[model samples]
Target chain A: MKLQRVLQYAKTLLSESIDAGDIAIDATAGNGHDTLFLTELVGEKGHVYAFDIQQQAIESTENRLKENGVSHLATVILDGHEHISQHVQQQIGGAIFNLGYLPGANHHVVTKSNTTIEAIEQLLQLLKIGGIIVLVIYHGHEGGKEERDELLKFVSSLPQKYVHVLRYEFLNQKNDPPFIVALEKVKNFPKE
Target chain B: MKLQRVLQYAKTLLSESIDAGDIAIDATAGNGHDTLFLTELVGEKGHVYAFDIQQQAIESTENRLKENGVSHLATVILDGHEHISQHVQQQIGGAIFNLGYLPGANHHVVTKSNTTIEAIEQLLQLLKIGGIIVLVIYHGHEGGKEERDELLKFVSSLPQKYVHVLRYEFLNQKNDPPFIVALEKVKNFPKE
Candidate 1:
């Protein structure tokens, strides 16, 4: 059997963690690819919150969802995902974050470490037990290494009692291939 | 769905790579658990070679295979895995190495970097196209950290054109939980 690539494994994780009628989130909503994926996973009974900071991304995701006739299942929000706790208050079964910039768009507006960590913290709080948060980290561009390093440091510090943080990476590849950092909630919220 | 632990993922990978009549190897047949597992995976039609440096390990594995009534399908060897090139000269479908000391045995007798890397090189040579070699690295014991570091370095430097080196690790766990390093042979051989 062929080993799944980064994106394929990411989708596999989401598919395994999410079921029909379960709430999901596309934290990046880049090109609307993952948003559309989440919509199908949650189905009509479930709902998806698609977040993006750029108007272009929001428009792209909205158009993709509309074209797929799945607009009703997902909310395309033109806001940073760090504010997800504001838009989505209920527990979610799964979420995905594609770090770095929107493909074929401005590379300057990449996902930074601080906001990304904040979004992760909020999502972890809102995640159901046994739920997963999949981060497809793309760190091939300028200032990308810093973000990747910071994100790795932050995730490594997460307490193991409540969550299991897994890092899936290809070591021999060139061109800084994207890697996956998946966090599975093993318990409820962290104890105060 | 709950994420698979290290051992489960290792078996899943082996099962996916090995066919019913394929040749397989247990590079470190510690207590023979993985050896027995591989025997089932390869089935009665296939063959397995299990190797260990310790006499006790070899005896235990031999007994387990005998008790399980599959002793005829596997050959137990009381030799270091670094000598794989001498005993096995055929292309293999898959192999597994459980690094570190044997469980419930002397923790000081752990696998080291030089011999581990040598065995990996030999296995890669003997692995058929699309075959895989899975390494379950347990690095919490004394002298284990150095071996882990060296092994990671060696695997990372493998040419991407011929091999795909993947590191599957858990970041948040307090203890150094065993992680998986899976190498898939994508090409016949690396160019000199």
Candidate 2:
């Protein structure tokens, strides 16, 4: 299978644990793909807070959600995801981030390491036990390599007592196929 | 979400693709855990060819199989998995390799890089299209680091047109948590 299909399969597998009425987050709501997916997974009673620094992304995501008839279930935020904690007051069941520039747009506007890391840290604080965070990393484009390297280092440095990190990457793909780094919050830390 | 439990989850997820009456292989039948899993997955009509370098592993695997009442479905081979091509004459649907010294045995006797790579290459040739190979790499023991490095280099060099390789590893863990490198033969390569 291609890396894209494999990532899709993984997202579906990870989302299986989530149920209706749960709160989810789309940290990088580019084009609303993951936001739509989270909306469906959380169902009508649930809520999704989608964030994007670019106004284009927020508009696109909102339009997509409206078209899907789930606009009421999502709150689109036009700001950097680093402020996730300030915006979201409730515990989140899951979060999804697609790193890199939005497709079909200027490649120069991409997710940076500092803000992304800050967003992850805030999300980690807000994540409930057994919750998961999936980051799909694209690193072939300009400025993407640095972000990928920094993010890998950051995630690798996280304490294992609180969260478990898993990286799923294709080894033989050319131009660096996007990879997934999934973190699941531990239910019982230090004891394990 | 310990590495062990995560590996178990991966095994269950990968096994969902296999069907009854399919031919499978246990490249390293250490303690027969995966061998038994494969036997049950293949059912009575199918067959599993399990291999091990140590007599203790073969005996333990045999005992485990007998106790599980699936002994008749598996052919336990008392040899290194490097000879898989010689023993397995038919097309295989899936293969599992546990790369490390068998538990409860002398830790010095570990899987070598040369033979493991040879077996993997042979299995790739013998594997039918859409077949999968799962390698659970344990590299925390003596002489294991070099083997892991060599294996990763080898797998990373494989051509992408014929097969796709995925490396699943925990980023934050002590003693280098064993990771999974799964290879699946492309059903429609080049076209994609």
Candidate 3:
């Protein structure tokens, strides 16, 4: 399937009945495929908080949204992992991250596992009960294997009652450029 | 993940948003995991038509349902792919097939691609609008590669307006047993 198709499918999977007028996030707004999807799903009344570490990525996403006539529905922030919680205030409906470097630019500045996992932790807190988080991991580049492995390990450790995790990829394919990792937060999180 | 967990997740996916009085099918009754799931989902006044070529599979499934106290709700038929249309009369709410062999049984008596494709054709006709058909394909065995590749090709060939196909797998894991393949029949399927 095409990359945009994957993003579209992710949006459908992550959406719940409660998301009719709720907030959503795009943790990695690479090329704006996911950003556009989130904006459309939330409609004019709902809000989208999108983040991209690279200025070029942000600018490209901004341009794409403007061309698609959905820029007003989303807040595109050019910030790293630390600013997400501050930007996203309301309980979130869903969040999606396409984790890798930009397709045609900055091939070397890929996402690191440490910061990605940290971002995941922060985003998980932002999600409400039955809310979902989707991560598309591209483990075909430098440090890709380590990141993929670490993310799997972390997700596997999630307690059975609090969260549900799913991984989707084409096993018959050769090199794994990217695969979909999804987590849904349950309502009754136990007191820590 | 354990096979039981996978089965549970599959059951959840198949039952979500479905009503208690809707009809459903288990195209493969391997160990009756899905057959039993459908039996419970449809509840009283509803019916399930479970099909498998192997008599042993049928016996095991019947035994499982009896063990679970749901035998009254299901009909386990020891029949081949061509018998689906004959058994499932009305449009169904959902159908599922755990394609591959019965776990820990004779792996030689596997579901073939041609028969599966034919069964799918019948199911599309037998499905109601907004109904679902889920196929769990294990592409790690001897005939698995062909089945997986061909099934993907067939599902991909469907018109976008008629059906929505989703492929879910883990790209990181080596020799992953199976992944989910789900198809949702659009409301506007052309009248037969």
What lDDT score belongs to each candidate, Candidate 1 first?
0.93, 0.85, 0.78
Give lDDT: candidate 1, residue A159.
84
Can you rank all candidates by TM-score, best first? 1, 2, 3
TM-score: which candidate is best? 1
Model 3 stretches with alpha carbons more than 4 Å out: A1-95, A98-192, B1-6
Top of the candidates by DockQ: 1
Q: Tens-digit lDDT track for model 3 on A1-192?
A: 221255455666765522657798888887888788888788888888888888888998999899999889999998876568877767888888777788989789888788888888887787787777888888888888888898889987777566767776543344564667878776546656
Candidate 1's TM-score reads: 0.97
Candidate 1 per-residue lDDT over residues B1-192, each given as its tens digit: 378888899998999899998899999998999999999988988999999999989999999999999999999998999999899998899999999999888888889899999999999999989999999999998988999999999999999888999999999887788999999999878456
Candidate 1 chain B least-lDDT 10 residues: B183-192
Question: On DockQ, who's better, 1 or 3?
Answer: 1
Better of 2 and 3 by TM-score: 2
| Order by lDDT, highest first | 1, 2, 3
What does the lDDT read for residue A106 in candidate 2?
A: 80
Model 3 lDDT tens row, B49-111:
899888888998999999999898898998986579988788688888888888878999889
Q: Which tens-of-lDDT digit does each residue in A57-171 have in candidate 1?
A: 9999999999999889999899899999999999899999999999889989999999999999999999989999999999999999999999999999988888999999999
Please list the residue runs of candidate 1 whose C-alpha ends up more than 4 Å from where it truly belongs after superposition: A190-192, B190-192
DockQ each candidate and list the results: 0.76, 0.58, 0.13
Q: Report the lDDT of model 1 for residue B180.
A: 96
